[model samples]
Target: MMMTGSALTDEAAEAETLVHSTKTDKPRRIAILSYRSTPHVGGQGIYLDYLSRALVERGHDVDIISGPPYPEVDERVKVIEIPSLDLYAQPHNGHFALRPRHFKRGEDLYEYFAHLTGKFAEPLTFGERLKRYFAEQKPQYDVIIDNQTLTPGLLSDALQKTPIIGIIHHPITQDRQLALDAEKSFRKRLLIRRWYGFIAPQIKVACQMPIHITSSGAIKKDIMREFGLKSEQLRVIPLGVAQEDFHPRDDVKREPLQIITTASADVPLKGLIYLLRAVAKLRDDLPDLKLKVIGKLREGATSKELEALSISDMVSFESGLTREELARAFCAASIAVTPSLYEGFGLPCAEAMSCGTPVLTTDGGALPEVVGDAGLVVPKADPEALATALRTFFKQSDELKAELGRRAFERAQLTFNWSRIAPVYETVIEEAIAR
Candidate 1:
């Protein structure tokens, strides 16, 4: 069938009109700077990966000017690789070669040695690199979204004129204080404090920057308390999940009674010790209960607590999975737990609920703030309360658990989906740019 000449002309006119219409509003140009984006590592990388993708999906031209182990972003989004001393390597799987990649110069070698001596060097070097990026590219992005690098490098003497908005996921000072509380010897405490000294600049920059965004009100308060910023100085935007991707699977066989937690080990702020003890206390009643951990467990007081409670046999560790795998695990488990002593925002709590699994979280930091009245909440650092919550869920019939899970799913759908979050981010970016 052949189209008429008028139909073809009409199509051409519509195409031209659409093109001209789009040309009127300049597509937002964004520059996101991150020190590292190692897939298996920290929350900074995940924040960079998702937020940039969301921006690009909404017709924004985004660029991630990142250091080593670049983020997994949409191929359409430009990723400008900016190299620096990538010390504190996270033992890349199946390849533990100690060979250096970029430490050719004396300065690079010195930086690597500095990291070996428990000093953090990436944020400092990455800051220097940001200056060069602006000097050469000279790309005037609408706004520079710094992914909590908090390095003075972004605010360097040369680049001070450039408008940059700092994103502090949570105050690193909080992490430092928790580490001090968890330390054994005075030397360990000193070394831990020294390592966190990198955060001092972050606190300074977050305070000085004209605009600041954090993940939660809890974190906003912490940042203000730690850095002494005014209420108006901080903007609290909650983190979100991809609702379509996180729904539960009804067919996946439940493991008698299984519980899931992400990044559960190593970080004292996560409060894994209390969870382990809770599990230990319940092992007699719910003998089939299992813990599926989705992060590398650091051998600290948390691990020692597990040993002391003799709950090590019931715990299983899994790490380095893509977001899809994480969602599947969320479905495969019965309940999701976030035992953090503090969270900027409890992302896993929302993510699991989005997957249609009810969450049991601590009333620490932002967990209760994010979880609201939907999921079970208990006091921080209390094994007895955690055990009671776990016991209630275990004894409840599937019909009840399913009902609570449905409410959780609705809460996540209405509140914390990425579609809901990205527009708020856009508003913040525009506000900063206008200034």
Candidate 2:
């Protein structure tokens, strides 16, 4: 039988796609670097775990080279431990961790003094350890990717000979500015500047890299502007979601007038204070309104704000929840909220959407990019706006809420799942190796 012209064209396109997919599916040895990778502490751990797992699933050999508080990754991916002083893990903050033994080594002395002076020296210290480790181990990798370390050691000629990419989630400059703006004391402001002194080295390292990966375009632009790099230097590969681990639980009953959010840190950047105030404002009219924050409400400005607002009784906080437990928290809530002042890729927002929860998020950084049209968007740090959005959401009937959840889940399947995102990463890795 003679094939029609359209049928021939379709066959040709299918063949081209198959060829491209097969080329990308070819395995390569990959090394992922992370200074610290504790999931609840920050997104670095999550990124390393998910990306390594996704890449390995695509038939790549993946290993994580990390410092203290190492990442918990998939069984197939190996984790190479590079120990630091683990200063943060010590009592009295990092002060008590310092000892006469630290004085014996130049790098240890630098780390100890820097921490005592309120400067974050982990990245540099970790880099020194990484350099020494590489010198001794001499492991081979086709491409190496650093997760937000941006250390001087990455620029070492030994490692630079390999195809290396740096992942800058977002500019720490933004975080520094937000912290400065939040603090009123000059001494504390000075300390904030001191803590972020690593940004200078980070910028230097980022600018020298051959290629970089940022989670969102918003972050890519920020990196270019902050690190003095051109747009071509950066690749925008949005983060992935573990959809299987965070799917809808229809058997879990949703709580009435209850809201859930994940704010791992009680910082100004998280915008939890605004959400607290909004909850305070809405609780009178909706007396049953309750909030469950998936983070510790430590004694700090946020806790003090809760006391001032007198809404402490209306709010509850939890931490260290497993992924399945977190999904259940999302399922049981009437809606999920992420009121961040800024985000690199808004992984929590994507997680909520994957769980088929209707989300109400602030248009901060890449959050709007993550939520898109599936969830409600409010301006960041505006209690009035947040409260209004909450009120509007609560006013909706159960059918509308379920419909929103369905849309969120559908959107997650189309855009946020790892099955689609992992290949983009492979393409970038291949390009770096070829270059």
Candidate 3:
């Protein structure tokens, strides 16, 4: 059940009093920094939204400082917007049409030139703006939580006034490598490298941070290796699902032949092309099979793959769904698949399980850690293995399917609930503050 504004504030106050009575320090005032935080854009936005709310529920004062395409944060949590060029949101080729007046500010000129050269400069530019913001306003916080905004400007003197802890979902080095591996052309590969040029600064900044947090042991290892940081410098704090929103609904009847996946279709790391291929292979045997994708059906590799496989009619796409809508989508599906090449933590896998849906996910990065033994596991980028897994599920009796779904829900309740995760985050924040 959703709590009203007064009730939420009262609960936070009580929790704060309880924490203050036990500890010397008052309730921590935290500032979470995100370069870009729009929920539908990527998992980072969702992470900020849920984490900020969860922290507030645990009696901490949380504020998200973000760039455009801002997150839909909880009402109780505050947001501080640090405006950017928002080049991606431009109607058409806005980067190429910049006027002479735009060159007045160094950041504006840098952002435009970077976009024109096919490079992502948001992280660097956001850090610069944030540094300036800190210098001008001198905001006070017990700790600053850097949400993967590993840029040199964050290391600037103006922003180093408070103790900072960084959360690295996963090293972007993996993303760059995967994209390069997927592309065959030399020019395209070069462009991909240039776009991911921020990784070098990210690595440098990450190594300099006193502490870094990740969602799973797998990601912890990746960050350590990628940034050349010691094991002790990194900590793993698993993410939580919103049980109130994603809980199972007995009233929602599941579609026996329906499969669902949440992914950004164009990104190679999401491995949507393989899932489509698997669906194409299964359609002959299970002609009624339908795949529902919770992402944009952009005219890219995914669309081309669907057209090439002649299975376009069997698939449907959805974007910008609210949590309630997404939960209903999970409950109505017979099974959910996460075919990512890698993930720091698979939020959709946990959400699907929370909705009492059996999940089939690749053994990518931290997916196995999230799925545990509650769902099916397959090798990454292997459409044949995914197809075989789907066929096996199709052969199962309804009774067995329902039983597996029950197990998935039970596992999520025990392991993925926010009630269980918030305390761990609080401990991490305390550690950062103490250091």
Best by lDDT: 3
Candidate 2 collision pairs: none
Per residue, candidate 3 scores C-alpha lDDT tens digits across 234-317 of 767777888899998878999999999998548999999999999999988999999999999998899899999999889999
TM-score of each: 0.88, 0.94, 0.93
Alpha-carbon local distance difference test for all models? 0.75, 0.84, 0.85
**Candidate 3: clashing pairs of residues:** none
Local error of candidate 1 at residue 403 (angstroms): 1.7
Point out the higher-scoring one by lDDT: 1 or 2. 2
RMSD for each model, in Å, please?
10.8, 7.0, 6.8
Model 1: CA > 4 A from native: 1-25, 90-110, 297-303
Q: Please report how far candidate 3 places residue 392 from its true position, in Å.
A: 0.5
| Residue-by-residue lDDT tens digits, candidate 2, 57-144 | 9899999999879888899999999988888898888787877887877789899889999999999999998888888888999999
True-structure RMSD for candidate 2: 7.0
What's model 1's lDDT at 207? 73
Shift of residue 319 alpha carbon in model 3, Å: 1.3
lDDT of 1 by residue, 394-413 (tens): 88899988887887888788
Quick one: ranking by lDDT, best first? 3, 2, 1
